[model samples]
Target: MKEVKAFAPATVANVACGFDILGFAVDSPGDEIEMKLVDKPGIVIKDITGDEGRLSRDPRDNTATVSVYQFLERIGAEKAGIEVVLHKKMPFGSGLGSSSASTVAGAFAVNALFDNPLTTEELLPFAMEGERVACGAAHADNVAPALYGGFVLVRSYDPLDVVRLNVPEELCCAVVHPHIEVSTKDARNILRGEIPLVDAVRQWGNVGGLIAGLEQENYDLIGRSLQDVIVEPIRSMLIPGFDEVKRAAIYAGSMGTAISGSGPSVFSLCRGMDKAERIAKAKVEAFKSIGIESDMFVSKVNKVGPKIIY
Candidate 1:
């Protein structure tokens, strides 16, 4: 095929206790990328939509094009020309893995168009490079799930070992994005450089419990494991009504609630779609009580990561 299009779903990074390590994808609100092979011998970003002109068209700067560029360079196909068009369906800085979705879409589309020189997991390094271009750090929590789908655990980053985890069928996600911007850099800067050993022990247990809960399909254990002792306490202060929102979600039958990635967006695990929707509404109302507008999404875990659209 001369051209191809792909879509990648938004992801929830961190997943509470597994900071910078765990993530899962959601069904709605994703990014799309269209890539067309050309004779120009260079990557060109022809268009970007739904970004409100905020995204860079330069291939080196934009996540979508940069991902494609990196993939081609890695494959020694830098001399091959490609044109990319990105559709940012989701909001930026929403802590919903916006850049990851775009980056995955671009990388997936180009790889498919090129007849799959790399496997889905093999495309991860290029996608991570795209993230590094977007932010200063190359984090795989968001990109891993967005590319691999379902739940993923970044077991180690040295050799870049990522493991896809089991997802409970009844587990649902409710995400609420308050209509406020949370700078990822600023949110990260506010975190404690070091924590007490007691907190570290608690966090390690919670992470282990979360993994077991997911594998065993134990919702109650999952609820108990959603506590964050290290990052949430500090970063949550940036999000207004965070405590109230969490309380509201739990009251609305949510298993647990935590800040999605950095701030502004909060996520909860629920038993089913009904509970997920209720939690979403409750979180929205909680934000409303604080005079903050918000956007909400309720979805079962997305098992399919990225799809070829054309």
Candidate 2:
């Protein structure tokens, strides 16, 4: 095949206690890319849509094209001509893993166009490179889940060890993106360079509990584990109405709620879709009360990550 189209789902990163290490995919608000092989010997980003011209088109600069370019280079196909068209259907800087979704789509599409030369797992590093370009850090929490689906745990970044975790069948997610922007860089920077040993101990226990809770399908444990002692206390200050939204979601039956990745978007996990929907509405109303507009999404955990669109 000379052409291929692919899609990758949006993701909620950090997952409360598992900051920079855990994430899960959602069903909607994803990104897509159409790629075609050509006789010309380089990468070309023919067009980008849904970003209001905010994203870069240069193959070396854009996350999507940069991922594809690096993939081609690794497979000794750098001389091969490829054209890409990225469609960003999600909100950028809303903590929904927008850049990761686009990068995964481009890498997944280009690999498919070449007849599946690389497995999904093998394409991860290339996608992470795109993240490095987008955020100055090649963190895998978002990209891993967006590429592999379901819940993911980044056990080690140096060795690039990643594990896909078990998600309860009834697990559902509610996300609300308030009309505001939070720079991931700024969020990370705001974190104190050092923390008390007591806080670190509490954070570690929560992370371990979260992983075990997911593996055991224990909803109560999951809810208890969704507390962030270090990051949220700091990063959440950047988002308006953060505490009110969290309280509203909890009152509406959310198992737990926290900043999705960096800020602006808050996410909650519930036992069922009904509760997820109610949580979404509650958060939206909470933000509205503060004179802030927001968008909401409710979905079960996406088990399938990127897929062929055409």
Candidate 3:
């Protein structure tokens, strides 16, 4: 039996303007999974580690475990059973795309084990499937970038049109994962069903402008367009120091700052590593004052999505 290993990166979604359609990867943190096909006809999961006993091993409950099983079933495994192991290296509900990374690793591992019967592009739907089980909704904004890397402009879902933009440089960004959990379903429930037409128009304008800014590397324009009057204000109330942390990041010279996902985690884009570190520091201080412990990840924009570690 051939052993297949896969790794996937953590992601930050809701980059101010794109909301459900945008995300980027961060370096050093991710999830890994290994899989091998056996002669048995069923799928079995074993050897889970790294997560604080948070990830479920049941195929129906575990995002990574379900990914392998779904992919094998779709491709007709031909009497080959699956043995899977998950290394959930990222924290749950940290807005770091832990579940998405886990899903991506599992899907790619199974595909590679079967001698890569699917192309990378062909693999997205399977990854999407994995996320549906994980987050209730199949929002691929986080998963796509974690799986494929780089900034993505998800234009449509029916035909799945997304443009992978060239990253201008190894940009510095900071993630402050406050020691808190916001379930995906709760986050969704907090969102209002209706928005003013004027606000909708402005939101689309910002989304379009942000795309152009990224494409041209116009830092000023990008920062200006990173305004979210739609979702951030409503969700910010849930996080203890959201307002102060954002203000501190901007005052500390961050180009932009926003909630990472359905977050207690927040991210700041900065000029360099030093600025990123300072932003992380400011964020920690802001959270600590509110009685929340936080972990800071000083990372750059990760261009390489995922790679096998062994």
lDDT of 3 by residue, 104-183 (tens): 89887877777778877777887888898887778889888987888886778988887787666746788899998887
Q: Model 1 scores what on Cα lDDT?
A: 0.92
Please provide, for model 1 over 1-310, each residue's C-alpha lDDT reduced to its tens digit, 9 standing for 90 to 100: 8999899999999999999999999997899998899999998899999999999888899998788888887788889988888888998888999999999998899899889999888899999988998888899999999999999999999999999999999999999999998988898888888899999999999999999999999999999999999999898888989999999999999888999887679999989998899899999999999999999998999999999987
Question: How do all models score by TM-score?
Answer: 0.98, 0.98, 0.94
Which residue segments of model 2 deviate by more than 4 Å?
none
Name the lDDT of candidate 3. Answer: 0.83
Give the candidates in order of lDDT, highest first: 2, 1, 3
Collision count of model 2: 0
Error of 1 at 115 (Å): 1.3
Whole-model Cα lDDT per candidate?
0.92, 0.93, 0.83
Pairs of residues at least 3 apart in sequence or in different chains that clash in candidate 3? none
Instruction: Report the error of model 1 at residue 67, Å.
Output: 1.7
User: Which prediction has more favorable TM-score, 1 or 3?
Assistant: 1
* Model 2 score (lDDT): 0.93
Clashing pairs in 1: none
